[model samples]
Target: MLQWKEFEAWVCIEGEETVEYDVQTSEDDRTVTCWIASELGKKFSIHWKNKAFLQDVGGSVKVDGNPCGGTISYAWRDLGRTISKSGIADAATLKSFVFSSLEVTDDDDALISSSSSALQDLGLLELTIYPVRINGELESTVFSRLNLSDLKVHERSKKAVTQQIKLAEPQPLEKAPRVLDIERTGPEVVKFCFKYRPIDVLRANGIAPSPSRLKRKASAEPPRALTPDDLEELADLEEAKNLREKLRALEKKLHKRDKKPRIKDEDGDVIDLTQNGARNKRVKVESDRPFISGEVIDLT
Candidate 1:
């Protein structure tokens, strides 16, 4: 028994709504064949019958509400009809089907025809048979039919449809310079290796040191010796010190004498302090004579 399964229907009816039919033959031998019939007045009548003799056909039929009489016919051996029956026998057997037809007018002279015997070899002729049938009887009818040429089975292992995406290698991080773990010391300890005699020699001589190194060394070691010329210069300084002391004593004596009381006459004579007590007391004298101890005085 011929098996029909996997049926699919695609129908395009011009000026009419598309209709789909899914029919499956029962596995029981008693329900092996069936007929689907539709009648819409005198305009159209479609009859589909399935028998044990015709089992490889399955497709959809579109009846025009105003079909031209005798403009279309169905051949029992047509691949479309065979596939239509096969599709109805088993819903799982049919793969795909399309039925399309175009109307033609008497005034139009250009007619398109497509002969596709190649589609019949590959089972695709079922899709083209209906359009060709209607095109045969109508004027100015145009029909286009497509046939399968190559059946290519892709090997999934050959290559992936999309290349395997690879993440870019992470950029190597820059390495930081290795820092030495040095221990810090105090400023005095840090100066341990520094030369100290230069500064010490300058301080001993009571001379300020310049930032540049000295060209000549006055003394390389401590406790610098004094030459005879240096001793003579020291003696001169001692003598000058003595003179300054004597001068300071004289200035003290002069200050003490000026602090004492003194008397002076109009003629600028020094007065004796013991006799007249002029130094201790203020006295008025007559202008005619100045007397000392009751003696008459004469004008000079």
Candidate 2:
């Protein structure tokens, strides 16, 4: 909820319609005081009627001298009671102060009870500026109010605000693990190591790992120079192996030939081409010559 009095003070001093203000300085010019007349306050009547005073006003304030590193509080009093209060704190630089309104009256305040015309007759506001320093450090200059007895106050309930937020769950800790490192030894090779896992053997060489077994096999049975007798024996053994292979092939061919049907005549008698069978059927001839077909021959 916006403090009406604080907004009114800020807007009257810094608003676009503010135009200018009257400033009075001390004899030494180290302190400056400023305020606005009620006639000038009339220009903010529209704001008052539309309750514009209930909004926040933001502006920066410049004091004539540097502030001490401390805080100062101010309050507007009417009829022995506090109507509004504000606070200012000296920044770390000690050259300026940050201001904030602590409390302010609502629309029912006595200062704003009368019409703008009537309020103009009374002194609107005043600021008494002074520099306070403690421990050689500049404390915030306190502004004391004066001649605000004619103001009134109207009380109301303060505004209430509530906020809700969602928070994420915290993460759990992780356990320690053995170190694993990988490095490139060459364009086609990669070297890897695990401190506690004995993994240096997995290093990739330029060739595929499948041929490693072949290398082992070659080493297992190394080749040696053959003696003369050994060479001759090997040649004989090779010849015997070839002869055995040929004999097996011949046996296979003879077995296939035996499986065929024997040649027979129309009377179903098997024809024997052996010497005795040929002599029994031979045609008597004076010389060894070809026999003519369809010749009747005697066999004794």
Candidate 3:
């Protein structure tokens, strides 16, 4: 929002995006002029003057070959008197002692400039200049008793309503059930398991009850312990005994290699024992010695 003290009046001429003018007034009832040019080589002239109070004053303006209407008014105060014009509503007020207006002019090649002079002198003070555009034309008029207080009252009422709404409390939201609170007793679990399987079809397919199937049948039972002869037979199996011994030896060899093994090959290749070395050492080979013949290397 912009402050009122900083506000300046603006005019949109023929819906143009650029090209705006600032309006100013002279302290005394003297002629003031401004010139503007359009892109099409057409020009305009604006003129204004100060008046004593709410009274009628006339000036002349020419747009191309067309004539425009103009007027002026004034407002008096202790500091100075305010002078205004209705061509573009540019107004200014200052001390009576320092008031002057010289012949104003602009020489932009494409712009048209016209002279504005007061037709008659009047004793009016405190004036507002209003310029009306009728049918794409400008006409000037003076106004009295203009007040903007109603706008301020409406704004205050809106702000109060907005503050009241903001101070009100918000409503609570509904909550959803928690996962752990859902019931899961024994019978419910059994029923859920039954829902997952077709009981009649499973029985027809020779699937016995879980408890009965878990129990061992006497005739098909395995021996509880090995007999003496069975133990001796296991001991006599030389391949099994050799495998056990080889596994124990491998365990011991790996332990020793981990602690202190050669880190390089005979050819100076860096031996990575943790990865590549283990895989490379697992290659099978048939030894000529009968004692170590058909031995399988277990790198893992």
Model 1 is weakest, by summed lDDT over 10 consecutive residues, at: 187-196
Task: Evaluate residue 24 in candidate 1 and report its C-alpha lDDT on the 0 to 100 scale.
Answer: 35
Quantify all predictions' global Cα lDDT against the true fold: 0.29, 0.28, 0.27
Question: Across residues 1-300, which tens digit of lDDT does each residue of candidate 3 receive?
Answer: 000121111212233322222223332432222111122211112222332222232222222112222322222221123222222211221111101111222333322212211111100011123322222322212211211111111231221111100001222324321111111111200000000012232334443244467588668667689899988898889778899999999999999877633355555565555665555643343446566568764323
* Candidate 2: residue pairs that collide: 68-138, 68-139, 69-138, 108-154, 109-154, 110-152, 110-153, 111-152
Look at candidate 2 and tell me the lDDT of residue 231. 95
Candidate 1 per-residue lDDT over residues 59-114, each given as its tens digit: 23211111111111124554233222111111112112222212223332322122
Model 1 TM-score is: 0.18
Sort by TM-score, top down from the best? 1, 2, 3
Q: How many pairs of residues collide in model 1?
A: 19
Q: Model 2 Cα displacement at 56 (Å)?
A: 62
RMSD of each: 49.8, 39.8, 39.1
